[model samples]
Target: MSNQEKFVVSRIIPAPSHIECVSGGMFKLADGCPITVISPLAEAELSATLHDTCNVYWKATPSFSFQAGGEGIAADGYRLRVTAEHCEITASGLSGIRNAFKTMRQLAESERGVLKSTCWLLPPVAVEDEPALAFRGIHLCWFPETPTWEIEKNIRLAAYYKFNYAVIESWGMIRLESHPEYCWDEFAVDKKEVSRLVKLAASLGLTLIPQLNLFGHATSSRCGSGKQMLLDRHPEYASLFEPDGWTWCIANPCARQYLTELVTELHDLFDKPPFFHIGCDEAYNAGSCSLCRENYPAKLKAHLMYFYSLFAKRGARVMMWHDMLLNRDDPRWEGYTAYGHSSRGLDELYKELPKDIIICDWQYGYPEKDGKEPDWRTSHFFKQTGFDVLVCPWLERRGIKSLGCLAKQEKLFGILETTWHWYRGSFRKETLFVIASNAAWHPDWTPESNVVYREYLNRHLREMDQDMKSKKYIQFGSVQYQINPAPYQD
Candidate 1:
């Protein structure tokens, strides 16, 4: 295989189209990373990511002569060339320039901070590049230790790989000042931190989509010290499932009013993102209360359709979990209780829900094993039914890749790798984010897993190791946010 084909970074994961080494030359960040640009926006970006590493000089026009990319470069596409005299990165748009720097950062870190002229390193080469999909992203649900710095790094990491979308499941993060009664004061993410992270992610060219648990998963907060964000203060709204668990009573006429207030409050906090995630997944054991009984499953369907219109009126596209509507009984999930409710009528759901709403089909599992393949019909089915679909996954890289293939056949909007896995680096092949980024760009490009795994870890470990040099914490960058040190655990 050629050098580009042999390397995973070069071949896929936001891969460029063409690559040709100029031979015997390179660009070094250690030598002031100057960028000549006609746009003030590019200059501002230089001041953000590169200002700390080198004396970055940004100007309106070329400071040195070099060949630039010809016209007809795709959006978020870049052309790069380097030689012994000077190195040049050029593109017709800002996204292209942003991608070029990402390539540069990857090159610098891939070789353990060395200036070797490797393709992974900014080799003396002329290349053209663009993303495989329009909406490549990561979906983060808050874990106990989800600090501000960690979230920022993840956003920066996504940008480094040229991802354009991020879905933050900010459960009770934003200040609920508009309705403090529902806020979890102890662990609610600071409102300022959310604002800061949003701004930072924006600088990196990522559009942040805010997620709020509207119908299901409201109990997620009350499970621990995250105190009564909703149900306790407003038991009247709870779905009162069988003996105990709670989801919002969808049939209750008042529920929409309550949710509208919550949605409006979240919109105000996020400055109104174009898309909103109204988590309607696995609303297990719902419609039990007298209020939902008379309405039957129709109410279950109406809850989302009603709100989809409401959110649309406010100029936002609605996104929701697709499990409840798409759930099916599979042997892999037979014995254990599945989170997705099988009792719901999938046919009726297909007929009722709004066609414009984006469906997050989170079909997570080892989809292929011993020649048996996963039932990817849900992803394919959602698209055929006239709705945009996002395939979400965790664990199972090849299986996720398969999901992407199925997505390719349908209305594939994007891929969202859910959550931050906390496994020790030594045991895993690569972090899920890296694996996900690879799948996001080219899921059908199958290779030996071990080779791709090793390549991912080698580069990732080197980047994190470099971060340890200046900071006490084990992070990829100097901790950008302030907080008390986390308790050390063995």
Candidate 2:
């Protein structure tokens, strides 16, 4: 058999759009090989990516040569050619070059029968690739219990997997300068840390969009816990939220001003990205306050539009969860997860909301009554009503596949994979990241077997450890311990 027939097979994740194996000897990637880039814009990125590659495969960093122009390559696409003696990359932009290097890193494998070796081998092939969707992203949450290192790992992993955007929603973890009491004193992430993460994501060709719960989740804590981040300690500020402190009190002028300052602080902290996620989901107590009840849905409408206009002036477009815009009682979405109750009258706001406001429709499962795959009716509803929509899925495989397929087939905005509390533990985070990355990159690619999936995930985890310079054995695997530890010490 030819060298191409013996070595070449589909190994890269979100598999490349096009790949052709050439009949030649394997490319020996020895230490200190030369990496040439034809675009100056991609030089810095190539250096950063190659640093990781060198650490993974060689004892010394490869030499770099930069040139001027790449005419035919797309801004977000790349063409790569690998031969026995050379590996050439052609791209017009930083993102394309970054992607090309990522593909190369994934394809590299250690030389056989060599332990602790620095050399690696690559099959002779030519590849042309680019993401299918314009807004491919993953939504990650930083709760009070989450460690900063874990957040950094997730951000780096998302970028390494070629995701163009990441929505970081901090749950009582971001320290607000204006309102010091907004976050937990013990676990709050300060502005410096936030800025560092933003810069890190930017360096890796990933845009980090800030997410704040403007409507519901006023306490910046989960509903099940019933622990309020603000009111729990500063009961004096109770008027700013509903009686239960679950939703922000939109009727109160002071509450509106407080939220405005918080948004401004976070926006500036994140370097003011083009998109901001103003979470408006599961607002069960939206119109409960006496003043808010007097105005009903109109007050809510005005409150949301206020931020919409605020973001517009700041050169940003607003994104909100789609639950509040959908009526739970509507027969059209009988079996879907729609949280807009008729009493709150939030579904009516869909017509009034600005069409430019991107709707993030999150559905974690198929309809209870519907057949196997989810219909993704809510996303279609938003699109049919003249709003650009993103289909979000949590940890469900079928839901991820169905929503991703819908996004591709309907030409919707994109897919946003949410990793709320799952990022903490339980191996769910890794599973979600792998599946979501694959689905978003190529909705038509066949799902890999469990064995192959686990292998890719393990390699990803190991690469992350190398990138972070992790030393402890506990930090090596998906979980810290092989088995759950005892509950408490004596």
Index of the highest-lDDT prediction: 2
**Cα lDDT computed for each candidate against the true fold:** 0.61, 0.81
Q: Model 2 off-target regions past 4 Å?
A: 1-10, 39-59, 67-69, 368-373, 424-427, 448-451, 486-490
Looking at candidate 1, the ten consecutive residues that score lowest on lDDT are 53-62
RMSD of each: 5.7, 2.7
Which digits, one per residue and each the tens of the lDDT, describe model 2 over residues 1-490? 3444433444576677778888687677775677677764646655766666566534457666777776677666788888877788888887887788788878877777876765778778888887767788999989876778878888988888888899999888888889988889999888999999999899788999999888888878888998998888899999998887899999899999999999999999999999999998888767787877875789889898999999999999999998888888899987677899887777788888889999999888766454456567788889999999999999888778778888989999999999887654435755577778877887776654333555666787788888888988777756666676766544
Pairs of residues at least 3 apart in sequence or in different chains that clash in candidate 2: none
- Using all chains and alpha carbons, the TM-scores for the candidates as numbered come to 0.79, 0.93
* Candidate 1 lDDT, 304-407, residue by residue in tens: 77878878888999988876664457554432223554465443576677788898878667555468776676676778889898888767666667666666
lDDT of candidate 1?
0.61
Candidate 2 vs. true structure, TM-score: 0.93
Top candidate when judged by TM-score against the true structure: 2
Candidate 1 similarity to native, TM-score:
0.79
